[model samples]
Target chain A: MLKIEEYRQIIDEQIQMLGGMKRPEGLYDPVRYILSLGGKRLRPVLCLASASLFGEYSAALMPALGIEVFHNFTLLHDDIMDQSDVRRNHPTVHKKWDNNTAILSGDAMLIKAYELISKSPVGVLPQVLEVFNKTAIEVCEGQQFDMEFEKTSDVTEEGYLDMIRLKTAVLIGGSMKIGGILGGGSLRDCALLYKFGLDIGMAFQLQDDWLDVFGDQETFGKKIGSDILNNKKTFLLISALNRLEKASKKELLHWINRKEYEAHEKINAVTRLFQEAGVSEVLIQKRDDYFTRSLENLGKINGDHEMKQEIENFVHKLMARSR
Target chain B: MLKIEEYRQIIDEQIQMLGGMKRPEGLYDPVRYILSLGGKRLRPVLCLASASLFGEYSAALMPALGIEVFHNFTLLHDDIMDQSDVRRNHPTVHKKWDNNTAILSGDAMLIKAYELISKSPVGVLPQVLEVFNKTAIEVCEGQQFDMEFEKTSDVTEEGYLDMIRLKTAVLIGGSMKIGGILGGGSLRDCALLYKFGLDIGMAFQLQDDWLDVFGDQETFGKKIGSDILNNKKTFLLISALNRLEKASKKELLHWINRKEYEAHEKINAVTRLFQEAGVSEVLIQKRDDYFTRSLENLGKINGDHEMKQEIENFVHKLMARSR
Candidate 1:
């Protein structure tokens, strides 16, 4: 199996190479600054690992780098839309500069992603571009759905799942699928890998939701019950709302309606209500189901047992992390 | 020469195809609505005409359509950023819907542009993608330069030209160049075609600046001297700032510095100063020079005499238009 460190190094180097030109003074600096505040590099790593499962991982580097650039491009724009103050503990591009700068820098980053991907080996470029185009549109669709949900009242769990699947999971799936295509995998196998990644992504997002409410303060890196405070329609909250008795539903609505409440007290109230309503357990089961489904899909791939085991071990390590 | 109506129909149909079945409810409707409101469709028409100079104009439809979609996408986003209220005598997308929806829909339109370009016939997809990527990035660079100029004091005419070339010219160049490639033109001919289109685009933008200040009210179909009222960095203003006597420069600065002023008075003062400083004539001469240069470049392309004559006639017709 490929070491994560190796993939990280390649991605970092490629990103630097992508940003290695003298732009008009203020133009490209924001791109550099935003890319410098790093995260897990999870998407590109998935691309490389999926490619390695079929052929030389190095073959996937260019496309994987494209995925990383595309992800960061989305982040830059999303930050502006969400009015986020910080990203990776640094001021967001929009916060650091201005909305117009963020918009232009994000636009450039997106174009740069296309440029990098178009540089893929000739044999793979067409199919890779097709998949990339679809994924890009789906990501935009997902974002639209998300924004709609903020103004809507009738959002279902299924709708939210589909939205996240497009917004977050498909890109992760696309990362691996593009890698698989470049690695000479069969179309069927590539589809399976995409599904596997998507399932894991769903589980991963569920875990994030869980942590928002129940995580340990030191390890979670966010305050407990943050979603409740923000009126976020997480799986747990929506499920709880759907399943609660009339009295419990009213209580939840009351808390949700309040613009100001003591943080600790509200957190405790919501936590207790969630516990009584079995929302926490339900979310855990849903997360496990996705994880299990992802593993099952992974098992369908024809590869050496040792290679599969190595990937499974890596997955286990990722799942074990608290933050 | 291909009929402009034939090109317009193809582009309109192709654009409709881009907004497929799964479009988000409110988000994409405004984009489609705005697009349907219609304009001259000049960019796509130029693309087809350039392509036809070498072979069948129909061969260039997909890339031409891609250029049109991409252009409208930029307009959608730009309207949001500029807070403009009208487009083609109708309320702009952001005015009709909200900023967030406009932004998301504009994003979807951009993805749709990529999709349209990616699905171009197999032989030309690589070159199309390459040109599209470069043009897209240059557009962003232009937008960034435009935003940066808002905060900076030393915006020279050269700086403004560079910015407009990126922001407005390169996409037009890409449109023609991609069309030429699809029409089986030689690489050298394609390069010349692109240069021709770029020069024409520069002149077109300059004409726009002139119209903003001096165009006939009935013919312009927009508020006259609107750019002056908004204190935009048009070529005339920048030239006037550079060439004016110290007293006039100081007075101009006073008007520029005052954020609140009577619209009519400010427009009269700026126009008077620009005329006095010979800024208007300078801009007119620059526009004519670009127009002539573009024609010269068009003349240099190695093509059949009849084809060259056809394009030259079309350019004359375009230059003769008042708006």
Candidate 2:
């Protein structure tokens, strides 16, 4: 079985090829640009890793590229919707070009992704497409719910969790499941692998929320408490809201509603409230529980034991990421 | 064979089912809203008609819905990009809700379209998807070209024709080709059907350009010279620029470069230039040649004689629409 780095390298190479389409510069340039602004290539790597667990990882390469392209497509549009100026320390597509280019290029990238995924072996193409289409719809729904939550104050922890599951976790899970399908895993094993990926994704996202306020600034690669400054409805925020007493809850709400406070003041104040309410401990416990569950799910997969252990090691390394 | 109205009704009923997914009201509502504000349902109806010409029309139903949803998906995003205020005389999705909703909803609709198309019979699924994906990419490229032309002054007649072919004609051709594939038509016949649709689509768009200047406003159901008012580079405009004398070309360029002018005066002047250059007659002749070519391609199809004749009659009825 390939190491995680090997899988990532494969994904990176394929993404570079995707960027090489030169025609219709107005449409493809942004696609090339956004693909060049590299992320960890986590989803596709997981797909490759999962595929290698059961059978030939090579067969999963096209579908893996598909997932990467689809992920980037979402980021391209989401950056526009979020009005973000920078991604990966560079100007976003919408910022570099314009919204129309971003919208059209993103749409084209989606079709490109489908084109790539359609290369899945014919026997499994239908199943691969079904999972992908369902995941795609859920991701959009999740984004809608996330936007809706921005204006909504009474968001429940369950609602937040569900939102993240739909927005982030399902794609991860779907990626692994697709890899499993393409790699010739039995349906039963694929289902188990999917659960494993979903658990890891949940933990990964919760860790992200945790790191936003609590991690080392140098390591996190983003300003700590940026989510707090934006009054984002993360798991920590919802838990803090639900667990806090009257005064603390009112104070949190005040900071959330304030339009003129200094950024650090708001961030510090919200961080204090979260700490005082012990939300950090609650969040860590919840994240750890998911991590454990993911390992348990992985334990049930009927794959080569050594490869399974490698995946377990990989999961630990991923969850151990500080940012 | 189902009448065009029956085919339209089938598409309408399926689109209704699509909107029935009531969860994520923010995402689904705009989808429902836009789909409800009806247009010709042209692509899906064409798919049904073409499918019935070869085999069981019902076999094409899901894919037909797919094409309709996809067509609407493009419109939803195009309206956002174009900043169109109204569609079918109702507020566009972006105008009614917001840009974010439109982007997200349009995305969900694209996914929904894929899900529907994935229902194509397993035997032909890959071929159907290949055609759909290629067509989808071309449509995006076409929209990109159209937008680019807004800033580009050197756009040639060939470029404009190619843009419309990508933007409009391919979808029409793709719809018919997909229909033929699903209905068990010979691959050769499907290819012929695709060309037939493409030729008709080219003629249809040219007709639309002609009518923008010449049709009665009441009959056109839009401002008679809206394209002229917008400085859109239609076939007539391009033809006039190419066919005119040096003096006349200078005059046309002057009008095109003018920053401010009365809409009717500009439209009238441009219309006069087109008339003097005999561009209108050229355009009509070109459109007719395409119509003739479309009939010739249809004649080459080895489908049932009566079915072919029905399609020929339908083509005549469609082209005869003055507005």
Candidate 3:
């Protein structure tokens, strides 16, 4: 079995070899540019780690790369939809190029992701595609729901959780399941891996919500509270809304309503209100619940304990991030 | 073998059965809206027609519907990119909904297309996906080149043709090829069908360019010279640039350059200049050459002559649009 670091190295090398970067510079330049930005590479690594637990990690490299590309494709489109100016502390695709270029290139990336996974073991191609397509459509649905939440004030905590599950967790779960499938894991084991990934993915996103308000600026690589400033309906905000008294809720809404207040002032006031209403504690508890559930699910997976422990270590490293 | 009407009916019915219209009204609403505002359903019909030539057309119905969904998906995205306000006398998706909705819904449609085609008969699923993926990527490349052409002044006639081939012809070819694959046709026949569709599709697009400046407004459902007013780099414009004398080119450019000329006056002068340069006859001959070649390719396909004749008739009906 490969170590976690070895799986990561394999994924990175495989990505470099998957060539489509050529002419039509307008189409591919952004693809190559974003792929080169070199984020955590967490998703593909998880895929390889899962594969290594049951079979040769090398056998699953292509599918692992496919998951990574798919992950990036979602980010590329999401950046445009959010009108985000920065990603990885650099200009976003829509910022570096134009929106038209970003949209077209992002579309190409989505199709390329399908092409990447298209070479799955022939016997398993249909199931792989089933997972891939279902996840893809759900991701789109999740994005749609996120956008809808922005326009509505009636969003519940359950609704917010479901949205994130669709938006983030499914891809993670699907990736691990895909890896397990490539590893020739039994259906039961693959299903368990998916549940583990899903719960862990939920924790990962909630941690992100937590980090947005509390993470160190230097480590996070972006200013904290941008989510607050943007009125993002993150778990912190949603939970705060659920728990805050009418007066406290009114104060939170007032701070949220200010369009032109001092950035730090709004963030401080909102964070203070969140702390007073126990929003932070609620988020921490729920996040821990997910984390525990994820571990429990991971424990149930039928694989070598050593390999599973390696998987557990990788998750801890990711979840423990401040950046 | 089926009649043309039967093939079209089958496609339309299959489309209605492929349901996803539900909540997140912002998302599926536009999908239903655009699908409702249907056009010729040409690509999917071609898929069915090709399938009927060798095997059970009914078996290929789902995939045939997939081609239509895929075609509409392209149109939805293209409408946004082109900033087109109208399609088939209806507001474009971006106009009807917002740009974000159009973008997200268009993405859903693309995924939906893959889902539709994913149900290809088990024996042919991989090949179906191969054709679909290649065509999908090439279409994006075509759009990129088309967008690139807008900024390029040195677009050659050859370059323009290649762009249209990628942007437009390949999908037609791919759809027929997919249909041939579904029908269990011999590889040689499938290839011939692709060539047939390529030539015929090329002819179809050229006729569209011709009709844009010259067709009947009532029948065409759009104003003539719209492409001219928008400065579209169509085959006519590219060919005129290729063939016109320097002085004549200057005059045409002068007319083209005028921002606020009387619409009819500019249209008449351009038409007269095109006639003087023999541009009209040049286009007519080239279009016919493609048409003849398409028929020749169609003849080589290993299908009954009657089925081939039906496809030919459909081509003639499309090509016989106003001069």
Candidate 4:
């Protein structure tokens, strides 16, 4: 049984091998530049790992890369939508190039994703396309809801969860399911893996929300509490909104509305407010619950126990990451 | 025995049926609005016509609709990139809504196109997808080259044709091929129809450029010489550049390079220059050549004579249209 790291290594190598293209200097250059940035390659790793549990790893490579490309395509568009200047410790495509370049390149990346995923064996392609299309649309829906929530004053936790499920979890679920079908896993196995991935993805996102507040700068590879500065409606912020009383809520809103507060001061004040409200602890409990459900879902898959254990360990290590 | 009008009617009905969706009003509403502002419906009509030549019209309806959706998706994005405020005699999506709405809605529309195309019969889907994906990527390449050409002065006729082939002709070719495949046409027949469509598409695009210059405003349903106002590198302009004396070339460049010239005056100047250099006649000859080749390709397809003639009539009728 190959370890999760081995699967990741394989994905990394394949991604590198997929690199080094020439021509259409405008179109292909940005694609190569973004893919070269190397953001954990986690989705492709999940794809390859899930496939390896039942069949040869090589069979999953194209679709695995397809998932990664699709993921990055969204990021390219999202950066422009969000006006995000930075991603993965680098200037975003839109920032380095222009908005038109970002938009066109993103469109090309999407078409490229379809071309790559179409390489799936004919038997599995219809299902793969179904999953990919559903997830792709859901991700867009998620982003829409995310943007909507940014303006609304009354965003509930349920709405947030549903948004993240669509935006984040479904792709993860679909990636694993794609691998399962390609690897000839049983329908039941595919379903369970999807559930496992969805739950794990939910936990991973919540961890992202929590980490933005409490994570170490060196470990997180970003400035902590930047979400607070942007007024991003993360789980932590929403939970804190629900937890705080009128005065505290007003104070938090003031920091949010402030146009020119000292960054560190504002971050510290928000962090203390979150601590006092006990939202951080509540988020920890929620994240752990999803994480536990994911593990249980994984345990239910009727595969080799050793391989299952390796996947289980991989999930744990993912949550343990600070960045 | 269905004529092109019958195919057009079916496409119109299908497009109308695709309307009436709710939710994500910001996202889906724009999709519906844009689709409602019908263009030629030529692509879908072609799809159904080709399919009807062998298979039932119903069999091709879904993929035909898919091609239309894909066509509109490109228009949605292109409008944004070109910063064009108008399309089809109505406000473009970006103008009606905004850039972000246009971008996201366009993304969703692209996903919707895939979903619709995925409904291609399982037996024919792999080929349908192959054609669709290749066409999609090529369109992006064409758009990229089109943008690049705007910045460079030395764009040749060959380079422009290749760009438009990728941008315009390939999708037209792919649409016919898709219909042929779904209609149970043989590989060779499908290939020939694709060639036919490509040649016709090339002619269609050249006609578009020609009309943009000399077209009657009411008949064309658009402002004549708008392409000249935008300094578009149409065949007329390119041919004139190749034919003009050095002094004539400098004078033509004077109008093109002028940042603040009267729109009518500039268009008149360019139009007169185009006449003097014989580019207009040259373009007519070029367009006619492509149209003839397209007819020749259609003549070679192994379909019934009457059916071929009806399709041939459709081709002529399309080119004969003022708008």
C-alpha RMSD of each candidate structure in angstroms: 2.0, 1.5, 1.7, 1.6
Clashes of 2: 0
Please provide, for model 1 over B1-323, each residue's C-alpha lDDT reduced to its tens digit, 9 standing for 90 to 100.
25655777777776677555455776678767867877777788878877877888877787777788888988887777677898888899888887767777777777777777776677777887888898988887787788778777789999999999999999888888988888888999999989998998899889889889878878777889899888888888888989999999999989899988789999999889988899878888999999999999998998767767876777777666664
Interface quality of candidate 4 as DockQ? 0.81
lDDT of 1 by residue, A1-323 (tens): 25666787888877777677577747789988888887889999888888877888887887788889889988888887777898888999989988767776777777778877887777888889888888988888888888787776578888888888988989988988898888888899899988988998888888888889978778777777778787888888877887789999889888888888898888888878888789889988888899899999889987546556666777777766574
Which model is ahead, 1 or 2, in terms of DockQ? 2
Off by over 4 Å in 4: A20-22, B20-22
- Which runs of model 2 end up more than 4 angstroms from their true locations? B257-260
Of 2 and 3, the candidate ranking higher by TM-score:
2
Tally clashing residue pairs in candidate 3: 0
Give one digit per residue, the lDDT tens place, for model 3 in B1-323: 44778878766766776655676777888888888786788888888789878887776778878788878888998888889999989899999888889888988888888888888876788898899899999999999999999887689878998999999999999999998899888999999999989998899998888898878998876799888777789888878877888998898889878888888888787777677777777778888999999999888888867888899888888888665
Model 3 lDDT per residue over A128-151, tens place: 888888998888899999999988
Clashing pairs in 2: none
Q: Tell me the lDDT of model 2 at B226.
A: 86
DockQ, per model, reads 0.70, 0.89, 0.76, 0.81
lDDT of 3 at B189: 92
Q: Model 4 over residues A1-323: C-alpha lDDT tens digits? A: 45677877776777777666455789888988888888877788888778877887677889889899999999999999999988888999999999888999999888888888888998888888998888889899988888888988799888899999989999999899888888888999999989998999999999999989988778887788889989999998888898899999999989888999899999999999999899888989999999999998898887667777888888888799773
Q: TM-score of the candidate numbered 4?
A: 0.97
lDDT of each: 0.82, 0.90, 0.86, 0.87
Model 1 clashing residue pairs (backbone):
none
Ranking by DockQ: 2, 4, 3, 1
TM-score of each: 0.95, 0.98, 0.97, 0.97
